[model samples]
Target: MITEARQPPGGGIGIAVRDLKVAYGGTRVLHGVSLDFAPGSFTALLGSSGCGKTTLLRALSGFVPVESGSILLGGEDIARLPPEKRGMAMVFQSYALWPHMSVHQNIGYGLKLRGASRAEIDAKVTSVLSILGLAGYESRKVTALSGGQRQRVALGRALAVDPPVLLLDEPLSNLDAKIRLAMRHELKSLHRRLGLTAIHVTHDQEEAMTMADEIVILDAGRVLQKGSPEEVYRAPNSPFVAAFLGADNVIAGEARLDGEALAIRLPNGGETRMPAARRVEGDCIIHFRANAVHFGAGSTRAGLRLAGRITQSSYPGGVYRYEVETPAGRFLVDDERRANPGEAIELLIPTEEMHVFPAGMPSA
Candidate 1:
């Protein structure tokens, strides 16, 4: 069984979802999911499409009704609160901007609806435009702006309300790759500058890993893992998390607890000890990134090494991706130098960097 993390920080208007569950009438979606978002911290809800990440986000905003659970906002159960009453704002993938409203009007619309005076709305909108770097263009219609500018306007609108929490649903998806990367840094900076607690939902692994202080990886409506970006990436608890986090190379087989050491039996009738302190059992898989596995022209490690014949090679951009057939199995090897097809080579994975997971174990 997977154990919960213990290093939770306290005191924040940030959300804590305990035993949270949601479903569509008869079919269950989220399963007893729990997560914490600290005030002024950025958290990403990451998973493949249709994985209930959006549902979970909506639940946090009180848009989706929770069947059971407590959405503790500053330790108060606000699960039953209406979406508008929660004092949180969200930005959608489409920007969700009103085409008919000018940038300024759209930004100040929220405050206006809340009965702010005309002068107050104008003042808030002016400050927001300046803060979001959209100054001198507040009068422009939404349709006249470029994608990045429109994104900024959307952000300005969200921030104009000064909500304690900000929910971003794939806010960078529509931008080009370069623009997206730039915006990611901007968002991080904005978070730090404003000290706003933000929950971002994204399917892009790099985006989530880059922007979030912590990540909650979800799959099939359940959280597979949650940890600091490095913790989840370096020490994933399952094969699924490893694979999901881009641990593509695999040497899966059987293993047993031989006293304190795990004796992993190789496919070619060889066995290796993974030292003591291994927890998982039964069939297990060890995954290393393709970049982690390399083609060594000369073998340095003597025993317990893989000797494979490189059968395919492709120059994908600056790096070489190679397919190696070994005595144990086939593995993808990524190298900087080109290896001629059908060349025999040795691939080494530093034991310390190898991520291992027990078979048949479900992700969180």
Candidate 2:
């Protein structure tokens, strides 16, 4: 819990991070990172470990000092403000709850430190507990609660302060798979109901895609792209962004303008033609998700098709995934029907489903 800054009714103010840079031991971690978080919108900072996502979150929370940057909140610069004065609350990866304290006491700890009256603290804590569905657990020790209940206590504590902005550092990563999925819905609902601006940091792609209104994909301290989950996933600006967004199947080839279509000629002498937003030529890479690749030939053939033999197959519930070896290379394909290993199969990828990027260009 941080400052008690009131937001406008229905939503909090937006955050504008400009040219933010940070370093530890004279080695730069974040090199000129910038982003805008819409008011009341959920934005996820997504990237692999050591990509400076955590550093950026900590910098926004006033815990990590920036080398050169400005964090604008409500038209005011908070880059140099103390953590307790930033008008924001952060829920950490660990619940960070006091084991010895009761749920109510833990939720009221920040208020107590601020010299809030007992009556005010109790009221705020009680209200937050009810909102988090832990109304009756207030009197129980935090250690006695389940993992999900303890997480709610952490969230309740952060909400008790009524900060305009909430920062979550993989808050649900500590939960089991099932519990984590449940908490995702809970957090999304809570954010909407409270109308607070939220910035969530996570390495999980599904977490970001499911929870965020907008996703910022970062790598090596630089932002690769920032857009709605659909936009980034469907139309990545580069090979790196495409690959990072779960388009793991890639094929490198020569691309050229063939009439009104962008034609890609694979090394196997096959060509795939797709609609192009702009004219592009020369070497390029085609990226698509494993699920985008279909099995077998049909009346409606795909633009990119390859003949291959299944090297491995596994039934993962709804769909059977097959590792097919083709002229290009091995690729994983998801299909409804089961195909045995060593069986011949034709893999199909629709043109629109493939992400095409010029070779060696990592950005748009």
Candidate 3:
């Protein structure tokens, strides 16, 4: 465990993890994952299932032991501290409320364990319920409430302790689509109003992008990228991040290094000039989102373009999705104007909004 430096005359409480590693038996799950959270900032740790996000959160909460590393809380090393001593609260995905208890009792359970007076607990519970918009249903059993209500009750319980940091483990996964979106807005507003430092774990990219100030993208137990939602979305550093963050149409091509640009040789022997990729290689893949390309404008004159025929079409809502067969490979494109199948279309590729990376990158 690392012994952090003492305050040199001033003080503040923030959380930092250094060279964190965790393993299950023989196989390692996390490898040297490190992150820093400001005292009043909200960040989200996002990755697919089994990517070790939950494992890392559990380790921070003191529910799991770290194989090798240190967790620094309040400017002191706390890998050895017990859960209660860490002064943190967690809201799980399953709404883990006691079914037999009333909403009031559920919200007051943490204070009771901390040994607060009867009147103190009552006041705190009433205040919290009012804050959570659950005042009228305090006497009602937890089982009688809706899913969103239960979720709010769970949140109220976590907030009653007034921990400096909040850790949420996929707290919106179980709700319906509309409720989930509403909860996202509520959580965002509540976090801003309360000024709570929070780290939320989620696999949903949209949830992370919409709710978090900074997004930490993880894969296979390692943090792949950490930045604002716009940064990660517009300028992805790796192929894995680009693909995992959303549906990206990736193409395999041959890249040759130019002065500050790259000449890409398409599979059909066509060539296009693009910005210099990270690695100069014989083969690589470039990904663009479906909405990034414009349809039916002939070969893109300024940037790269491939000849493709619209093979299939599907309407999800406002826009139509088209599967186009291109020379490099197939690609999914979104067209606002609908068209029948077997129509010829040109995918206009913009030079600025394209991503190029090494091939054979692993998937989530």
Candidate 4:
């Protein structure tokens, strides 16, 4: 556990990005992106590759030149400042540690560059090593460390500077799955303990959901949604957002107003009514996760009922996953019960788990 004496100072600074734009040659990577990071909050920039998530992070760190707009740190525009002068530290996706440097040297390189004395560097490195659970490995060369250790060294280097904000660019992407899970807890704990504002860029949805206080999802260089993990997952505003967030079972239907409820008529002559939030009275798309489906129609809930034939079955661990073929489309369903291929099954999807969006929306 890190003590108060070892905690980095001058944290809890807020950041605001306004109309930020960046381009690579003729292609604009960030299309007028704007967002905010509350003081001491951890925000994750999440999107598929080419969505400009990394570009946004790099722009904030001053690694990429901004084409237009401002990046405000603590209410001061730092968009024009150089990376070092921006008062932020970044942990790269490659770890970016010097191969010849020892752990202590790697962690203290920033301080040494700033003309700190040998004694001062030693003390700071020692404290940072302890905080990173690497106190005894100070003299070990970075090249000799394991992937997880190397990650810690990279993080330690950033933390040693004690900047008010930290930028992480998928720092755990290279670690093995088990180590990655463990590091997630460590990083979250460290962020809370240090109270530093953090902006993390990641393509992994689970990582963003688990580690971030807020999730900013971007698509095609545009902001799609910004909310807590649950908010975005539960109430996606568009078909693209819903599909990207793992609502993979999509069905096409036509919706009509049925009293205060919305009735969806499927091509297979099946109809279901769900409480309507938005008055979508036309062709629409409905999406739900595999786990949201049950293997029976006995439930007395108001939801979609689909008759499907199991085309494939596999066990990926705790549950059985089945690919069900229906008249509309093939859908993936997860359940604990074992059902063989070619077996007919009834899919029951609760109304609360269904996400309805108008047709012709982007599903990619």
lDDT of candidates 1 onward, in order? 0.81, 0.86, 0.82, 0.89
Model 4 stretches with alpha carbons more than 4 Å out: 1-9, 258-260
Ranking by TM-score: 4, 2, 3, 1
Off by over 4 Å in 3: 1-13, 277-281, 296-301, 360-364
Per-residue alpha-carbon lDDT of candidate 4 for residues 1-364, written as tens digits (9 for 90 to 100): 3334457455679999999999999899989988989999999999999999999999999999999999999999999998889989999999999998899889999999989999999998988888888888899999999998899999999988888899999999999999999899889989998899999999999999999999998999999999999999999888888888999788888999888999888878678888886788899999888788867645687788889999999999999999988887888888889999999998877788989988988877
Candidate 1 regions off by >4 Å? Answer: 1-12, 258-260, 269-271, 275-277, 296-304, 317-319, 362-364
Backbone clashes in model 2, listed as residue pairs: none
TM-score preference between candidates 2 and 4, better one: 4
lDDT value, candidate 4, whole model: 0.89
Model 1 residue pairs with clashes:
223-364
lDDT of candidate model 3 versus the reference: 0.82
Which numbered prediction scores highest in lDDT against the true structure? 4
Q: Is candidate 2 or candidate 3 better by TM-score?
A: 2
TM-score of each model, paired residue for residue: 0.90, 0.93, 0.91, 0.95
Task: State the lDDT of candidate 3 residue by residue for 159-214, as single tens digits.
Answer: 88777788999999999899899889888877776677889999999999999999
TM-score of 3: 0.91
Indicate the residue-level lDDT of 107 in model 4. 95
Clashing pairs in 4: none
